[model samples]
Target chain A: MKPIEARTERGRRAPPLPSPGVRFGEGFLDRLGRLALRVRSRRERREGGGEARLLGGGMEFVGFRPYRPGEDLRRLDWNLFARHRRPFVRVSRRESSERWSVLLDRSASMGTGFPGKLQLAAEVVLGLKAAANIEGAEVDLHLMVRGEPHRHRGRGAALAEWMELLESTEARGRGGLARLLAEPGRFKDARALFLVGDLADLQPADIPRLTRSGRDILLVQVLAPEERDPTRLPEATHGDAVRWADPESTGVRTVRLDAHALAEYERGLGARLEAWRAIAAHHRVSFTTVTSDTPFEAVVERVFAR
Target chain B: MSVPQVAAALALGIEWSRPSGLLLLGPAALLLLLARRSARPVERVTATFDLWEDAMRRIPPAPRTRRLPPLPVVFAAVAITCAALALAGPRIVGSDPPRVFTILCDRSPSTSLPLQPGRTRFEVALEACLSELARRAGSTDRVRWRSQDRETLELPVGVKPPASWFARPAAFLPEIEWEREDRPGFLWVTDRVPTPSPSHALVFASGGRGVPGPVASRGGERVVWREGGLRVEPAPGRVVELRGVEAGRLGPLARLLTIWARERGFELRGGQERERALLIEAGRGAGETRELRIAGGSLGWGLAGTGGAGGIAELPEGAQVWRFGEASGGEAPILVAGSPGRVLLAFDGVRSVEGDPALFALAWSRFLDRWVLPAPGVVPLDERRDAGAASWDEWSEDRFEEVPRVGAGRGETTSADLLAPALAGIGVLFATLAILLSGGGISWLRGRLPASRTRT
Candidate 1:
C-alpha cells in the first residue's frame, strides 16, 4: 500500500500527527460533557431511536400544558383539573430511535499532507461517538472507503469499540464524495447527517443531492494546515521550487514555491470555499473548515455548533 | 630596494548629505504614478514569435490592490533614492596629505630589449603610461619619476608634464638608483619583479638577460661633452680585451673597464675563446712621411680631425683604417681593421696618439667598447641569474599586490564630504536601474524590442 502522508514533516511548534493512540489531555472525556446536541430534524429514524417528539406517549413526565379542545381526555390530569377548575394535560418526553449517520471520508487525498486529515477524521468520529453516548442517540458511522463502506452501527454500549474502530481506520481509499452520496440509501434513515472529508474532488453541484431534505446536514471540511495555505509550514520557503505528486491520482504539479504563486493559490482556494458555501447554503447544509491542529474537543464543538 | 604602499575599503544612515534630495521623492512619486508597475500576469503569451513581443508588452498592469513586479519597483525605487542622494551632498569628515607615488621607470637592463618593432620595452611601458591615471589633483596625488637620461620629474599627476615632456631616446642601465629616503610607501611599476614574495620588502632584481629574444639591437655608444671634461660611455654591458698596451701607460683606462663590467653585470670571457676580440699589434714607423686623416664610424663617438702624420705602419688589403696620426716616418693607423667578417681592433706598437698616450687610450677604449661587446641585449649572460630569478614566475601573474607599493596612511580624519562619493555610487546604480526598468535590458535579451507599431 502507498504511504498515507508525504512524510512525518511538521513545524517546530506543531504537535506530532496523532497516532492510533496518541494520548489526549486529562479530563478529555469530561470535556466532552460540555457539548450539547439540539437536533431539528423531526423525522423518525427507527422504532427505538430517540426520534423527535411529534406525538409523545412515553412514561417520563417532562411538563404540564393547558388542554386544547381536540386534546385526548386520557392525558388530562384529574387532580389539576379539580383544583383550578380548568382542563390540564400531562406532557412527557418521547424516547425513540434517533440515529446520526456520519459519513467520514477515508479518501487517499485526506491522508496526504503534514498532520494528515485522516488523523483529524479519526478524532471527529471519536467525538461524535462520545456526544451520541451523552444524548442517548444511536450512531451509524459510514466510513467512506473504496469498495464496501466500513459500517460501525450502535448506541451507547458499543461506543468504546466504535472509537477503537475509528482510530484504526486508515485513509487508504479514494471515494469521490459526489459519487458515494449518489448511491441509494446512503445513510440508512439517520435523523441527522455529518459529512467529514477534505473534499478534494467534491463538486458544488453535488451538495443538494448529498443533503437530504428536512435532515440536519453538517459538512466538515477537514484540512491539514498546509492544505488550507501551502505557505504556512516551515517547508514553504518561497522562491524555491517543489514538485508535488497527487495522492488521489498519478498527476503531478511542478510549482515555484513563491509568494506570487502562493497568493494565486490562496485566491483559488477562497473561490473554492465560496463555491462550497453558496451551494451548501442553498441546500440548507452547514459547511465549515475544521483544521487538524485545533483541540479535538473544540473541533467536536465546531462540528456540532453548525 | 622597494617600499610598501597605501590601503583597502568597505555603511548607511539617516544623516542626509543632500537634504534637497527630498524634492526628488515628489518627482519620483509622480513618475511612479504616471508609469506605475504592476504584477506580471502568469499567463503564457500565445501570440506567435512575431506578435509575442507585442503581447508581452501589452500585458495589462495588475489591479491596484495587487503587488507590483519587484524588478521594476526595485529599479525605480533605487533611481529615486539616488537622485535624492545626488541632490543631497554627503561628505566624510577626514584630513591628511595625499599620497606621493614614485613610478620607478625600470631602467633595468632588460627594458632595453625591443618589445615591438621600433619600440623598446621601456618605450612601450612609457607610452602606455601616456594615458594618465584617474586624473586626481596634483597637490593631493603626487608623482615622481625619472626620465631614461636620469632627469627626475616630480609633480602632482595633473600638473605633471605630458608624455612629450619625457625626454626621448632614453637609455637603459643594469640597475636603477633607488631612493634612500625612508618614505613609508611607494608603488613599483616594473615588468621585472625585484622582490621574492609578498612577505618581505622587495629588493634589486637578478642579472640574467632573461628569455634571450632577437639578438640585441645595437643601442649606439653615448658620449657627452661636460662643463669640465668630456664624459664618454659605451653601449651598456660591453666587454673588450686589450693586448700589448701596458696599463701603466694607459692611465685609468684599465680601471674604467673593470668598473663598467661590474656595473653592467657583464661576464669577462677569456680572449682566446672570444668571438669578437680585437687584435692590436705594435707596428714600426719606417717609410716616407705622409699626411694623415681620420674618418668612418669612429667619428660617431666624439672623435674629431687629426693632425698631420708621417711614417707609420702600412695596413694590408681589406684592412680598414680607423684613424691616422702624425709619426716621424709615416702615418700611423690609430685604429685599424680586424680579421675577415669581424670588426676587431689592435694598435700595432707605435702607440703615441695626439703625442699623449693617456688621452688616446681613454678615447680608444670608449670607442672600441661598442664593437667589443656582443650586441647590447644579446643573450643575457647566464651567470647573472641567481635564486631571485624564480620571481619571474610571480611577474607572469597579474598579482601585483605581491610586489609592495608605496606605503602611506590615509591622512588624519577631517570632514571629507562623504555625500559626494555616496551620490556618485548611487548615480551609477540609478543608471543601471534605469536601463533595466525602461526595457533597454529586455530589448537586448529579447533580441528586438516589442514594436509599438514600430517598424523594424
Candidate 2:
C-alpha cells in the first residue's frame, strides 16, 4: 500500500511533457494518423449507411441547389418556387460556401508525444472534416497552423479540400484556446467550434462565456500518457527534473519531480480534472482529453461518445 | 528583659498557633493551587493555539499596575526603627556573676618601660596582682589580663577573650584608663603622662626599645621613677599605717575590703570598722554537753573544741573575746558547752605567740567535730524540730542567710563587683540590637514591596 502511494506520488510531480507530441516521435505520429484515418472511414461507413439525414442535426440550413434524383423529395424548394419559381431542391444541410475556422494550438506544449498528441490533434481535425463531408457540412479553414493561419471557406468537395489543407500545416507556438473560440468568424454560422489542443489552457470561467453566445464547443485536450499515469517505475527512481517552457514567453521554470512532489502533483491534477468535469457538466459541453499513447481510434470513439 | 516584650513575642507565637491565624497561610497555598490549576489551562491553551510566541509574552505577565520599588524605603524605615530601639537601650535580664575572680592586668605597650634597672611597670603591676592573688589564694579564680603589647586570660569572663589581643590597640588601653580612674592608689602603668602620684604607688611602661629615664621623687622620700619611656616606681613612702585607726577612720579601706571579699566570695558581715558583736551565750539550752574553744590571732585564727556541738569563729584586731568559764591556758582557748549555743569573740590586730603545730592541732580538732556533725544516719535538722516549728529560724539560731545584704555604714568597694552586671547588660543590649537590625529590618522591607510586583 505504501509503495502504491509512493508510485502515485512520484507520477504526480512528473513535469508536463515538452509538447504532447514529444512523447510520440515521427513514427508515433504516423501510427496515430493511420489510426485516425481508420476511425474516420469506419465512422463514415456506419453513419452514411444508417443515418442518412444527419444534415438536419446542425442548427442552420445551407442554401438550395439543383435537385438531383434520389435526393429526399421532401427537401424540395416550395418556398423558392413561390419566390423565383424554379424546381430546385433545398440543400437542407449546413454545407455552404461560408468560411469555417480551424484554430490549431501551436504552443510548445503540443509537441509532447506518446501517441503523438500534436499529430493526433491534426488527425482529429482531418477526421472531423471527413465526417462532415458525408453529412454535407461545408468547411472553412482558419488555420493557426504554425504562427497564425488564414481562414478560407467553400462548398461540397471543398470540405475535403480543407482537411487536406489542415493535414499539411505544422503546429507552432503560443496562442490562447479562448482567443480562437472568441473569434466572431469562428461562430459566424453558429458552427461547431472544435478546439484541438490541451484544454489546460482554458480556465474554468471561460467555459460559460464560450457557450453563452450559443456556439457549439467541443474541447479536446491533448495530454501525454505519462500525464495520465505519471507513476514512476523502478528504473526511473533517481528522479526526473523536467524543465518546461512557458510556450507564450522566453521564460522557463525547472520543476523537480520526486516521490513526495509527485504525490502533491497528483493531488493537484486530480483536483483540476474534477474542476474541468464539473464545468463541462454544467455547461452541457463535450470535453475529452486524449492522452499520449492512446490510439487515435479511442479518441474518435470518445468524441462521438460525448 | 522587659516582661511586656517577652509577653508580646509569646502572644505573637500563640496567635500563629490558632486556627484563624493558621488561615493566613491559605493564600500562599491557594496561590500554589491556583498556579497549579492555571498551569494546565495555560499549557492547554498554549497547545491549542499555534501562537507560542504570543503565549510566552503573556506568561509571568507584565505588571498590571505600576509600582515604585518599596524595598529600599522599607529597609530604611526598618533600619531607623532598629537604630531608635538600640538608642532606647533594649536589654534583657541576666544572671549575677558566679563566684569567680577576674584579675584584670593591664599590659599595654606602655607597660614595657621600667622605673628601676630591672623592673618595668609591667613587672611591678604583675607583682601587685600576684600579691592580691596570694591574699585570695584558695578560692576559685579566673585571671583576665591585657597588655599594650600582649594579652592573656586563662579562661575568659565569657566563653573566650580575643586570642590576638596585641593585634589591635583597643583592648588594653581602655582598661588602663579605667583602672586609673576607678582604682586609685595603685600603680598607674603606662608610658605617657597622666601624671605620677606621690603617695599613690605607680609603675609606668612604654612600648619600643630604649634606655629608661631615671626614677626620682621630688619629695625627701626617694624611689625609682622611670625606665625607658615607662615609669615603674613605688610611692615615695607609706603616708601612714592604717592600724590603730578608729572605726570611722578606716571607712574607705573597710569598704574596699568588703567589696573585694564579696567579689572573691567570703560571706562578710558588719560594717567597715563597724564592730558587730554576735553574742552566742554559752549553756543557753540543755542537751548534750558540748564545748567549743576558739584561739589564735589577728593574722591566723584556730578553732578547736571537745564535744559534739561545735562552731568556729574568725576574729580580727581590737575585737574582744569573753569566757563564761575559766580560760584553759594551753592555747588561750575559750571553751563552751551546752545544747544549742554560740559565742562572740573579738580581737584587735595583734599577733598570736602560739607556734604552728598548736595552731594546726586546734584547726584539726574543729574539723573533726564539723565532719561528724552531719553524718548521713544522724537525725537531720528539719526532722529534729517539732511540728510547730516549721521554719528553720524557729528551730536553730544559726540558720544560713543565703545572701548577705550590706547596710550603708560599711563603705567597702562594691563597685568592683558591679562589673559582672554591667558586662551582662551590655551583652543584652547588643543581642537585642543585632536581632532588630537583621531580622526586623528584613521583614519590614518585605512588607513594603507591592504585592503585584512579579520577579520573573
Candidate 3:
C-alpha cells in the first residue's frame, strides 16, 4: 500500500504529529487486535479470501490450462507447450483486500457527553483502522464537521497521525454525514463506509442517501449515556425544575422535573431510536447504538463482526 | 393615622391599626414585577433538543413564573405581611394594669328579700358588685368595699366575702357628699336608684320583682319607692325620748343609738319627750299596759287586741302599721303611727340587738324617720311623674349601658402591646419557610426523599 499523502488547504493545515515513542495504551491495542481478528475472520468467510488457491499457471507454475482462442499470449506456459506439444495458459490466485472508510462526526452535540461522544467515536475509528491495517486493507479516515470533510489515509504511523489529529480536534458546528454520503467524490471507491455520530440532529430521510452508492454502510450511533436515558441525568432527576438549552441553536426552555415529564422524555427517545432503526432498515444499513461509556473495542467487535 | 393615634386606637380595640402600611403593598407588587421581568439564567446543554422541543410543543408551555421563584415570592409575601403587621402595630387592646375600684353595697331591709330560693337580693347585689370590681381590677389593682352605712374597708386581692356580710342589715346611710376623685371608679349596688351625680358612678340595681321606678329628686336629693318600703331622700332627723329604759340594758345598741342620733341631728332625751317627739318605752312588765293613739284611733297595749309579749298583735282601727317585725303571725310591729306626727316603737330583743348593733340601729333609725319625724325638705319623686312608664330600651340603657367620656382615664382605654410578640413570631415563621423553599432547600429535600420510580 502507498504511504498516506498529506493534503493541505489554503487556510487549514493538518494537525501536527505526536512525538516519537508515543503509542496507544497496550490494553486498548490488545482489545483492538481481538476485534480485528473477529472482523477479518468474518470478512474472509463471506468473500473467500482467507487462503491462497491455484488457477492457470503463472511464473510460479502452480497450474496450467489448455489455451483457448483469443487468450493472452503473455500468459502461455512455453515449457508446457514445448513438452506436451500443445498450447496452454498459466494462472495464479491474487490476494484480495477490502477498503474501509471510517467517517467520524465532530458536531457540537458530540462534545456533550462525559467521556465525550467524539472521543468515543475517535476510539472506534482507531479500532477499525487497526483492524484494516492487520488485514492489509486500505483505510480512509474522514472527520465530518460543518458539512466539510477532513480526510487522512494509511496505517501504522499514519494511524498514530490520525489519532493525533482526532485528539487535537474540537467538536463544533454541525455534522454533514448525509451530505458527505451524497457526494460520491468524497468516498468513490470505498468498499465499506463506517460512520460514527450521535445522529441526534439528522433527519430520518437523510440516512437513505448512503444507499445510493451501493456500498456497505454501517451506521454507528454514538451517544452519551445521559442522552440515551435523560431521566437518569442529574439535571432531570435532582431538582424540581431544570432549564435545558440547545447547544446548536442556543435556544432554551425550563421544565419541571416530574414523573410525567420523565415518562414523556423516555417515550420521545424511544420513538427517535425506533425511527432511526426503521430508516436504517429501509436503506439496508447496519445500525447500532454505542454509548460513550462503552469500550471502543467492544463497539468495534459488535458493529463490525457481522 | 399618626403613630401615637394609631397606637392609641389599637389600645382602644380598633382593628387594622396603621392602615397606612397598606402602601407597602405597592412596593411589594413592584418588586414582584421586577422579578418577573428579570430572566432566569439559562442552563447550557448539548443533547439534541429536536425531540424534546417537539415533545414540548405537543404539550403546553409551563406557566410563567415570577422573575423570582415561587418559594421566594411566597417568602417575600410572608415577610411583607409580617412587617406590615408589625409596622401597623396590630394588637388586642384593653389588657392593662388593674384600676382602683370603690364599691358601695346597699344592705337595706328590702335587700333581704329572697329573689331566688336560696339567694337573697343583697347576696345577688354583692356578687354583681364584686364581679364588676374583679373585672376592672388588675393584678395590682386595689379594691375597697364600702357599705352604704359603714366606712370604707380595703379588701385584700382575691379575698372571698363571708356569707354574713351579705346578711348584715343596713349599717349606715348612704353618704351623699362623697367625692369621686378618691378612686378610679365608684360602684353603687342597690335596689333603688340613687341621685345621679357628676362623679362617674356605676349603679347596679338588684332585687325587687320589677325594675325600680325611675328616680325622682328635689334639690340635690333623690328618692325612689319600691321593694315594699318607702325609700326616702335625705333620711330625716328625729328627737327620741327614752322613758323607763336603762342604758345598760341596750348593750351595744346604746352606742349605735347615739351615733344614729348624731348623724340625723336628733337628741336622745332621758325623760318623756315633748309633743311630736318619738317615744321609746320598754314594756314596764309583763302586766304593764301602755296606751297608743294613732291616726284618730286609740289602742291599749297589754289589752285584748294587743296581746302580751310574743303574742299576735293588731293595730287599732284607723292606725297604720309602717313596718313589721320578724315574728310569725305579726306578733309585733316594727313601726306604728297614729298620724304623720305621732309614732311609737317597741321591741322585745334589746339584749340580742348587741350581736348586730349597726343593723339594729339602722332599723330603729328608719322607724323613727318614717313614723315620728316630719319628711325632709327633699320630697319623694314618683317614677311615673319624673320619667314616665319604663320601656325596654330605657331599662336596658339603665341597666347595661355605660357612656364613657373620651380620654376620661386609663380605665376606659386598654393597652394592646401584648399582641406584638405573637404577630412578629408568625411573620418570622412564614419568612423562614419562604427562605427554605426559595433557597434550594426544596431541591435538597427532594434529594433526601425516596427517588421517584419513574426517574429511570
Which candidate wins on TM-score? 3
Residue B454, model 1: Cα distance from true site in angstroms: 54
Candidate order (TM-score): 3, 1, 2
lDDT accuracy of residue A184 in candidate 1:
43
Looking at the true structure's interface, with contacts defined as alpha carbon pairs within 8 Å between chains A and B, what fraction does model 2 recover? 0.00
DockQ of 1: 0.06
Candidate 1: stretches off by over 4 Å: A1-30, A36-100, A105-124, A135-138, A146-148, A152-176, A183-193, A196-306, B1-67, B70-72, B76-276, B279-456
Residue B250 alpha-carbon offset, candidate 1, angstroms: 14
Classified by CAPRI criteria, candidate 2 counts as incorrect
What TM-score goes with each of the models? 0.37, 0.30, 0.38
lDDT of candidate 1? Answer: 0.49
Span of 10 residues, lowest total lDDT, candidate 2 chain B? B41-50
Model 3 per-residue lDDT tens digits across residues A253-300: 565555656666778888888988898777667788978889887888
Model 2: per-residue lDDT, tens digit, A1-306? 011111012223323433334222346445545655665565445433422223333334445555545444566778876788775654444444323344556455565554456667766665565555543456555546445545655455553455456555543555546556656555566455666776646677787766633345667777656555445322125453333333333333223335544565566566667787788878766678767456556775676545
TM-score of chain A of each: 0.70, 0.64, 0.69
Candidate 2 vs candidate 3: the DockQ winner is 3
| Candidate 3 residue-wise lDDT, B1-456, digit = tens | 346646665566644446676576676677666665444533435465665665565555555543454657756776777667676655444433334566667665455445567875656666776676555444555566776544466666567556555444322233344344222366766554554532456666563453343244332234666664546465333465665466555545456556665665567667754422445554322332332211211221121112124321434333446443333464444333332333333432244332243444556567555544322322223312222121111112222223232244543544444455556788788777876776476766666667743462
Interface DockQ of each model: 0.06, 0.01, 0.14
Q: Clash number for every model?
A: 56, 62, 11
Best first by lDDT, ranked = 3, 1, 2
Off by over 4 Å in 2: A1-101, A145-149, A154-168, A212-215, A232-236, A250-253, B1-456
